[model samples]
Target: QMATETRTHGDYTVGWICASSIERRAAMAMLDELHEPLPTPEYDRNIYTLGSIGKHNVVIACPPMGTAAPYIISMTNIFRAINFSLLVGVGSGIPPDVRLGDVVVGTLEGHNPKEMMLNPLVEAENSVHVETWAATPPQPLLEALKKIKTEYELSGSRIPEYLERLKRDSPALASRYLKSDSLQDLLFDADYGHVTPDFANLSFIPREENDCRFCDKTMTVKRKPREMRVHYGLIASADREIKSAPLRDRLCRNFGGKVLCIDMDIARIKILFPSHYPCLVVRGICDYADSHKNMEWRDHAAIMAAAYAKDLLHEQDLQILEWLTPVDYGPRHRDFLRRWQPETGLWLLDSAEYKTWLSTKKQTLFCPGDIGSGKTILTSAVINDVKTRFQINPVVGIAYIYCDHRHKETQQIDELIASILKQLTQKLFSLPDCIRQMYEKHKYGQTRPSLNEILGVLHTIIGEYSRVFIIVDALDECPTSSGCRQTFLKELSNLQNQFGVNCFATSRLDPDIIAQFRTNSISLEIRENAKDVQLYVKRYMEQLPAFTELDQWQQETMLVKVLEHVDKRYDLA
Candidate 1:
């Protein structure tokens, strides 16, 4: 039940910027779920495919062949919540350590031809100082790189499995994506030229059809055959594509022979975007950056790059889940939700008031009932439903608090609000710098954040999301003697008024709690919920020993009696 139709620009977090149609197809093939196309601004020229890979909702797009600069900036604007950008495609591989179909993850260095001093660069061993623009992948991507390398070292890369899935899912594109045996990956000597024998005529035509068929085999560099591997290092970026072996080798030499690949897109992106814009360039080596370049390995290289990017994203999702937080209501929510009968909450889920709360902003749904009336259980169901519906979109934050009188000492106003902040912040790609700074400031002082400090962080963090749902279960259980409950309710009200955060709460029909929500929320009293009570009684009876062994009349009599007793107080648990 993916609600693709209702998705907006903010729903997407990962921007997969491709250079060619093959790369776009390869990216699409790697997606676990393909989302419907979202409407774009009329001025946006780039076409897009919305999809999901692991936990990330990715928006894949290919800029018009030679015009990537404008479209990439447009992509940044269009996908407003994009924290991670992946420049995925095929590029010319440098010699020695790189080969066709090998993937290159970039710690990109943007170079300008004018700024590079090539006059003294001819001393083959000497490193030349060039004024270059450099950008590293964000912290999360770098962490993912480390994790993936370790995993690959232990059990090998997942590329083969992903390729198999591609073959099974898209039969038509399988042959194209798969490596061809006939496409021999040849590396020529740096001095070898692909020009014909008539050297003085200045006719710049290749001797072979973009291959080394007519070239001397004795000049070829023999390499060992091995499985495709990922190489991480400096990737040089310039204004134009690299086609000459001498220039390619010189660029590599200038960088102390650390550049693994060369591409034309990365430089433009670095110049067009902000200095700190986080992006990782993944290039599959389609050809050696020499005279003999061809399209033979382009498809295979694109697929390899896409596969590596997908694996990195999966690792990133795992890292996000492991983010340390001060408070976690997940265990409490899970405990309560375990008692939920599958179809018992249909009445609330299908009700007009609940649907309205989900669709409208700054809305609240208050479920108040007597003690043991199943308010907490119904609250769990609502929390589960909200999570399921909005899980794919990272910008849609969902946080829940399960308050208990037993833990009133620990569940103070600040603690409850901090938990909400923790949940929402975890949904982001990285913690907001402001939140990080606040934590550091308090951490150094060895003091806890005051209620105002926590609320301030909460306000800032909530602004990062396009929408937020805050569910507080058993609100009446919060201590009222110290005005903790009042303060908590006021903060929720402020968040709702200022940020349009949706608020959902369940509690006993205490006069104070009822008065707080009476004017602003849609009230749903949980008492004598006949269908839920009947469903629970039937399920409980089925688990009993003699209930199923009895006749229909006896069963009916037992069921009626149980329902009658339970109907007075519908806790069901």
Candidate 2:
């Protein structure tokens, strides 16, 4: 039997799904006040407890215990009715460094359920299947977790206060399960096991009054406060308990040593929910999932997880989804930039012409250089400088493309335009109306825009910004045989002519590319500095072991030869 009245989806944006009664109770304890339970249909067996936490209507539920199937069913229905902005709950943890009540936040590497699964053949051979689920939580939730972690580290007493409050609320449960002293939190070697004696022999009976005496406290490992603090990494999720220490270590190693903890339920939630749904898993370490299982840390761990969740929800605006759709282009640009240090292009930064180009509008700078004359580094330096110069201006936008022959796909014209658009929109913090409309039209179908469509979008986005600067490096690396290189350069020229956009480009003196920009663009040839080259050759000759053993005349001859070769190469370029 179920109540006739149903709970409206608009009333609640956060859905907290707990695996056990203790976890559900822990979540409820964090709420400010409880609301009336809405009616559920007979077919829907979930028991929903509606509540409010800091102006947010939260619905908490605990599916039937002991199996994952019922929990999946409950979550499926819950998500269908409520578009949860936050989906999280307490889960079991299995990391040696993670203490009994410490929290572990999931990173991007930890959200792959497919990689965590055991192959059918391996499962058949072992007579068991390991469950590993991983999904990256939303960006906002991750940011909130980072803030809460900082506060916890600084205060050092929040967990104790939260425990005290829980004790006052439920005295009996606290006494039974949360009464262990800090010294009781011990770590045993993975190979160690509880001793089992022969029951058939009467001599095996213990003489002392204490419970079986096989446990050794001296074998425990010691840890510092920082070691027990909150951790952020990949979390392995599965339905069955991982009790073998060797297996746990193997899984951790197999996952590239990034798995900070293991959980039971997060994988199912990720597998069932839509990919766009915003969710985060915040779990406390209840057990090590080894031979040392106990009820002492269960209540305290649940409380800590719920307390952290409450802190995360506080003062957070639940209505905004600004951070939900993350842009991928930023990371790609950053990865390329990280290889070179800040001063790699110091020579280019010191140039007076480059300074003039930075302040000029509707100007095109074609920086032509030799293959190894450090053009790419100069382009990166120019991009960094432009970003710093216009960081405070909302009307200015900066975009860049680093072309490499090693990666052919990145040189595609559509990819180039898409990358530029992504950078501009990310800087603006919102997409232009035209780009948003195009995205909406194709997002559901997983269809990418054609080159012409992307060019139209880029044109619209450029018009939105008062001044836009585009830097394209290594134009010679783009596949000229496919005509993509020519087409892309033509678009840049068009942008400068039509929208008055400034273009900074680098190439290896390609005849076709030079012809396109030579008329109106400023051409700068990157030549090697003779004095710097001589200094480098001298340093190299001094460092060589053989040259150090040689006479002064021999060392001088080697330096002269190196300088002559460098001069010849520069002249050929």
Candidate 3:
């Protein structure tokens, strides 16, 4: 262990320890870009090194890309398995019997056969051999397969691919790629598999090598009596990396008789040197042909083919989501504020107090303002203010209080709760991963959120998403019992004091509602803020294109006249 040398890299140092690997070489290449290769010791004949990733140093060491050595070991969250900063098992598929052409879409069981009965050629070959080697997939794996299939079914028709989209917009990719009937067929899920753009090079495997008895019989691999194409999981190894599509798939299909991903020796590496090592696979679609026969797919072509493959199958589903990330797209909450273009926090309402009240982050306030006072417009402004000021990017949200004047009591409370839930969901439309994970943990959306649950969601938004803001218009119109109103107000006060989220309410100033808030919660009268009202009215008029032509004096004069003229008698509402 002492014989090994070490050197400084960022905060950490690079050195060679006893542990060694093919992946070590690839990792070194990447690490080397920052600096020269540093050597250390062969503690257990292992490869170890320390290099700076940024300011901090990373101790990266791997056995190899293709050997039966652990492909990776990462203690930190930020990891890269050769461009797969994130790798997930979308799931697996069977092979051979299931001719998996590039871009082909099928269910888990589509590649599996319930029974297997081969011709006489296989019958004479080895009944005992088939019985011994034929695969009976694990029931759990099968069940997972079924679930994936069901998910696909629920998704309905696929979204159009970039190629189809480009054709509509420019007609250029269509002209070039659409030339081939095989290519033209790639428009949608035209077939089981969307042929990858790249052609496969089957030269690596001897054409005769694919011959079989009961199934594809290379040497060790014995296919089931009834064959189906399925992508099997396997490990890979390399002195560096075996990125060649033909090589990877060929070795996997020919040698291991399994589906191929990036890391060639993960299974072997795990077995030989066990650890929760990460491995990544990124394959280009070189060919879709079942036979060794070749077509137009080549290296660059294969790259495109793979790109298209993801587009057709996985990427299509992810396209909508791509814009969802905060990185790719700016915060939607901010976007809403920018779009609304509110000048100040006040939402236009008959009562000045309620107008200012709307600024609260979360509340189901009753708007006591007179009718036609622009309550809805004012409420929208309140929500917009929170969104802009706090820079809260809500993933789910909506802004409104639906009122069925037809039924204000029992039906109204239920409706109010439902309405709030809907808006909350919109603000949380794209729930934070933590919130989503937690919600999924508790089965939230599956059931209406309890008051506590709703509060919890607000907390999550405050924690993970951003500052919470809610605008509920005209709760007074809701015909629920005074107690129900009190409960709702109580919850709001609790939320406000607890989470610092504000709620703004507009109502007709019902004495019962007022008494409820005063007794059970911190209540504020909303009818009297005349200055804020005047400002809002003026601001609203100022937005008119012609307002720019008017001088400041004219603006004030117009606002005062409108404010004084509008009927504010409490008896009318």
Candidate 4:
């Protein structure tokens, strides 16, 4: 049974890019739950399937043009929240190591940085129009790749199991997606050309049969039957298909014999998208890049790649909720993060002061803004950015607090300090001895630890990590009536001064809060940028009841008028 949920565009985190309907269908089959389609912009020509594979909300898109243009349009229009992308499909395999139906993930074997780039193929004195270099994929995906590969080494592949499940669920596609017989999986020698039997007569122009039935079976190369497996190495991609064996060999030689598979059109992604757009290519070998290639294994190959991707996502899902702590700000953090507009608040990330704060130890950054200045949303962006950057590093800890006046009673100084300890300990396998001892010391008496005791335990936990980031949003909301705010700020300063912890805080221009950081911290005033203001106004206008009734000019005029009013009042610069 397929469960359907209503989700917004920002909810999706993974972009599964496909070139053909077969690959699209393969991607859809792997979804655990299908989400209701959200409205897209008129300019985006690509169609998307929104669904979830494990914990990941994956947006699978098949471009109309099968090029980079449509994919870029779609990203700009609909996939604003996509963290990274995966290019999944079937491709022609490089021989000697890879066989038909085996999966190839685009990653270097070891630490060789040279494999990061693939030189363009020169055929007939012309260079192929494709991306010459590719950036590294996101760290989480790389970590998942390592985990899945380790699992494969220990227990073989789970791809066969997923394929069997798909066959059981979709009867119509079962026949097409079924594995081809080993006998039909044929490879011809590179020098052996598929030519007409009547070679003596020039009248014979081409081979007749699509299959190799009419060709000389004796020319087929013999290979031992092996289980379908996954390979990891460099992938060579081009603008066009490689149907010629000599061209494929030349391309492989150009890459120093490191090309594991050759795929068409994937290069467009790297060529068009920036390096920050993280992507990983996963290809299933459909045929050896030779004249004997046919559609016999393409369907099987597509499903094989899709099955591996699903398993990879399943592994990724496991890592997300592997730990639970007593106090978790994850819910609050997620709520604030959901309000973030894509591509907004990037100026703060690019600012020199913010960079210095991140690069230096024991640094504090204070951001003060007026009310309705999108301070909370920008803070959420910073938290999300920092977490994404250091997600794969076990020695880094991120703890955040979303202070609210309504919850001030529960968000006292001791509780707030302990929350940091709670979050950081979740990153470790077990609690530090001091924390466990403190808990035991107070458990029987139902007594709460003092602020200093909690801070002492926090100090112990902070030492476990190479670096720790403390982010507090809406710090002005921390209750000042009972001295909670002052105590909390003092504890944060003590941690930064004593333990080299990095602290990031956002509050209104409260004189007391500003006084604490004015001397020793990098301070930045949070102001709404013109672009972000325009985006916010446009999104709000789109939700109005009369928005659709207006013509294009009128709608644009309304947007311009609203932005002008905002600029006049706030001086968005």
Candidate 5:
């Protein structure tokens, strides 16, 4: 009974998801036999069209218009029952070579699937795979495409016959396609856009017919042969429409000229499918994805995409479903200090000695104080000051680490080094070749670097930047079980002494830790800056209504008492 149920659910061989109603209708028109709409669960909002195309049982679906999240949810729920998926839709073309009616088929490239599965805009330990999350079409689909191209070359294209069949089934779709004008398929130079005061305004307003102000023939680019063609390359998928030619060109170039078109929804679906579940995008070229996008060719483009999908599906044999188990790269961890770093409240910013050290050639500056002397706050202020001073210099990189006793697992020496390295590489926007090579070597396996291996990567990364500022706060809190603290300090000393990386660290004055920095480091005592504490205390107390209600003499007495208690604590340390 279980085997029969599994076989019934696995009968769906192809899944088709479209972005618009026109694309969905075009896809439905290609079906050989149609069935009644299958009942779905309440949570499943997708309106699925069940049918057979050629010898394959295909499921066609579309989400509510103008959103992508529901499409993702719908596809994921249906993907388990199907063997393969196709994101068939209309996308904007990157112009000059790609024309208005051209079809773009996405090809796969190697990508870190773990990074692509997560939201790219959110913060994560590993960098997001923004431009590299595409995979080539599977081997079977590529062979079918080649056969289709060869057939089209031998005989006339099948698109005309497909259009006739579609006309008989739904005249409305055929009428829309017939009304699509080829004269509106004009390619303009990248530098010339709609003549507006600012090109950033994206709202579309109704205009009278023949009122286009920027339709000068001088700005139009003429193509030699305006024939429809199939282009195989990277098809970028994003949640929003790309509207600038400069940005489109930049993305195309960044993807190494393999990106031929841009779509609103496809890449996200591709990344979430099972690794063995073959997927491809068949999209018609609607517009140039620039500022001048109009709805002149959308219907015609959708028809072209559906026609191409039918040609690819016709006469294909049923495939046996073989599930390939995907490799799981573990979750990426982040060492984020910006949210937890101490506030810079009336301290460190006014320190003349620290300012002098920052402006000069000092390689290391140590701020030692008792546990409650606001060392973390001081370190945070120094970080802010350095960032402000170096705001204009693109070559300077700044990173900080805050050690906590509560999180014992992260306090190890290797974790500390990895956190620091992650911060620096993220800030610099490019990793050193040495670190990249090391990562590539260990990427396939679960083996992480030893302490020595991490140190070697750090040493090489430090040489790539002109200057790097690293701040380590609460070093005394680092675990001391296996000489972790000593090893961490020794590595810092080496970075300062050998590589000239400017290191700023704050800790309680332990003789062992201080001794490590005594020879080449400049130490500043927080107790010496009593004025900063006084100012901080006064400002903090002024905000309290009860303290404000006290008499002047009472305020002074309370202030003195607070300072004396703090001083005694420092003495104990």
Candidate 6:
């Protein structure tokens, strides 16, 4: 005991409560060697040592073996009651990959049954339906373990949790090392060897060292300084042990590309906090399931891993890496508002049109009126609102697309046709049935369309149920070939009869354009000369402080005159 006491230790003591008396004694001996004591209490069979790690103090306790479920439940239930960081699991390892002397770290868990059984977070383009599962590891902690493993030799073990069990109630649940290939043969009929669907399917990305914003190019990395370093990686927590290729293949593929480590319970952890918490999985590879298996790395692996964790905690470089604490894992819950990346053409939209879009789902109805009217802006606003407002089965996007004609004048019937068709081809991902049928029948780009030919094409493209609103401004500014203006009128008439989409256009009120849609359409001419002139005058006067642009009496006179002019003609909205 005196020799043990002479061994210097951290201010805190650590040990598993499920560890037997002999294991506990070794734990105490280690603590004594480090100048720490095993104050982990013996309550029931659970072990907890009371001590200090830095300024914070708590009993580092362990529940029954393979008992993280109970241990975590109890730990969290009293999380407000305890001062420790977490309930870290310590267990056996599969030899060589995780030999008797090697130290290993357990960070993540895979609870497969819960994931495969639940139909959550399913949407288009994972491209197909794949089984789901939960993955967990607090990322920061898992990353710390990885850096530690690199400088020090480590070992891994499957069912190290079972080792905890052998210490307690059952000797039947084997804690011995077993290769993944031989894992099934070893535990074929062994007690509690059932495979629990693992939380292996979730998409987990690890923290990269050099995260640069300017490029998607791979980063060159180097270590920086920090304190309390945490390790992260892929973590799997399965109920029944998994040793098959299908399961291994899925995990191997994800981990091969992902910052792979192991952890347990992201889904449950996500549920634990309704807010956004990125999933991090880090686990010790317990066995060399691959052809090259080693059998000497187990016991010391965890200890070595723990040493790295300690080194990181004390290292001067800890603070430099603090920025890794926050990562933007876009909305995990479907009910929450989704954010759109700029590249996806979904930037942001907040407008009245957004409100109308959600409540009515109305696609057509252009913001009619002349130039400077907020038509496109209003459309963008509506699409943005749709992103936030509809929580369940959310609308993909409110597409705000515009066509800039090369002609630069008014929208011609042919130019308009060309622009609309181009937008459809460029933007819409799927070809509608009518469009597909029409394309199969006609050869495209043979030549530009005549006015009547354009109308025939428009009818096929814009079908019923889903209406695409066309906003064409300045019809009067449009230059036409000869007297095609009359023919343009005929095309407009055909659009309404066949497609039934509402058309919103602005123009100089040419007698021909007006007369064309004169039937079965709504039109009102804007007296731009009236409101714009008054607005310009009012805005100029308001720019001066204390009505200083003009005398207070003069301001009153001007304000009244502007109000009268504004209220007299035209509608705004």
lDDT of 6 by residue, 505-550 (tens): 5454456666655655544434334434455456555876866756
Residue range 144-236, candidate 1, lDDT tens digits? 888888868854765775776567567889988888787788888988976434552345654334456668978889888988889977777
| Native-to-model Cα distance after best TM-score fit, residue 488 in candidate 5, in Å | 91
Task: Compute the lDDT of residue 225 as modeled in candidate 6.
Answer: 25
Cand. 5 TM to true fold: 0.47
- TM-scores of the candidates are 0.52, 0.47, 0.32, 0.53, 0.47, 0.28
In candidate 1, stretches whose alpha carbon ends up further than 4 angstroms from where it belongs are: 1-5, 108-134, 195-209, 320-573
Note the residue pairs that clash in candidate 2. Answer: 111-134, 111-135
Estimate every model's Cα lDDT from 0 to 1.
0.79, 0.64, 0.37, 0.77, 0.65, 0.35
Those runs of model 4 whose alpha carbons end farther than 4 Å from true positions after fitting are 110-132, 196-209, 320-573
Q: Please estimate how well model 2 matches the true structure, expressed as its whole-model Cα lDDT.
A: 0.64
TM-score of 1: 0.52
Better of 1 and 6 by TM-score: 1
Error of 1 at 14 (Å): 0.9
Error of 2 at 80 (Å): 5.6
The TM-score obtained by model 4 is 0.53
- Which residue window of length 10 is worst by lDDT in model 5? 321-330
What is the C-alpha lDDT profile of model 3 across 465-525, one tens digit per residue? 3345555556775555555566666665765677655565666666766665553223443
Candidate 3 vs candidate 4, lDDT winner: 4
Better of 4 and 5 by lDDT: 4
State in Å the error of residue 226, model 3: 55
Model 4: how far is 58 from its true place, Å?
0.9
Off by over 4 Å in 2: 1-9, 65-81, 85-95, 109-133, 136-139, 153-158, 176-179, 196-213, 224-228, 315-573
